[model samples]
Target: MNDDRLEGAGGEDTEEHLLRSLPGCIVAAVGMVGIAGFVLFLVARIVRSLTT
Candidate 1:
């Protein structure tokens, strides 16, 4: 009952898995960048408030 069409079949290391996971990785990277930008913006605002 081993079908090649099935994915995540326990200890399977294939290129298809990498391809399938690529989009998730990209989204995660974008989210991290967005969070970093937000934090920087908040820090800048705090700095400005302290100076003024």
Candidate 2:
């Protein structure tokens, strides 16, 4: 029943940890989407070249 043991070792709670990591998570998500888009674009270009 000790709350201190339940909290983070750095004294920050789960919400605080998520808030601090939010920006990095956003950047990672955006980068993944960008890479996926680029790959799809390349695939489309290759398909178009093969068809034409």
Candidate 3:
């Protein structure tokens, strides 16, 4: 009843907060992946140079 309605309202605020921040979260994830890939690529190149 009244408690249920208050709970639902709180849920909506959390949902909206997540939706607002989702894009920033996605961009940070993508940036981290890209940085990891670049670091791996550099390590491979260095190892190849050492072996050859």
Candidate 4:
């Protein structure tokens, strides 16, 4: 919002830092869901195999 803030040499990296971290954050969330799904699938397969 302030001009001095943006022109300053090393005041902040808020936007850039957020942009940089976005991909890693997304990957981590997706990876967690993927792992959970895989585990559930494995459990379902094991249950099916045991029942039949």
Candidate 5:
């Protein structure tokens, strides 16, 4: 029952888990950057409008 081929039976599983989870991390990072950029752009536009 301890064969390496069995499910959830190796350090490789942890590495695989992390690899699978990487996409979520990448998506979150992109979303955060996009939101930050959008907010900053909006703020800059508002300031420009106010000054004019």
Candidate 6:
């Protein structure tokens, strides 16, 4: 028999999926920021080295 307790199943599933994915999203955002920072640092170092 079909389950009655899971009424509005689509919305519930979407909410649960979003909750599970939230951490991965945060990690991805942080990783992007970190990579950007590192690239900037490398570029600055290269520029400084060339000038010197």
List the RMSD of every prediction in angstroms. 4.6, 5.9, 6.5, 7.2, 6.1, 6.3
Q: Candidate 5: lDDT of 34?
A: 100
**Candidate 4, run of 10 with poorest lDDT:** 1-10
Stronger candidate by lDDT (5 vs 6): 5
In TM-score terms, candidate 6 sits at 0.69
Q: Which stretches of candidate 5 lie over 4 Å from their true place?
A: 1-12
- The sequence of per-residue lDDT tens digits that candidate 3 reaches over residues 1-52 is 3554455577766676667668989999999999999999999999999999
Residue-by-residue lDDT tens digits, candidate 2, 1-52: 3554466455758677668678989999999999999999999999999999
lDDT of 3 at 10: 78
**Residue 50 of candidate 4: its Cα lDDT?**
100
Per-residue CA lDDT of model 4 for 7-41, tens digit only, reads 44464766666676689899999999999999999
Give each model a TM-score: 0.71, 0.77, 0.78, 0.66, 0.72, 0.69
Which lDDT tens digits does candidate 6 get at residues 1-52?
1343354365666576667668989999999999999999999999999999
Candidate 6 global lDDT: 0.79
Model 3: lDDT to the true structure? 0.82
Query: Against the unseen true structure, what C-alpha lDDT does each candidate score?
Result: 0.81, 0.83, 0.82, 0.81, 0.80, 0.79
Tens digits of per-residue lDDT, candidate 5, 1-52, equal 3442353456667676667668989999999999999999999999999999
Scored by lDDT, model 5 comes in at 0.80
Cand. 1 TM to true fold: 0.71
- Candidate 3 clashing pairs, residues 3+ apart or interchain: none
Candidate 1: tens digits of C-alpha lDDT, residues 1-52: 2343365564474577778778989999999999999999999999999999
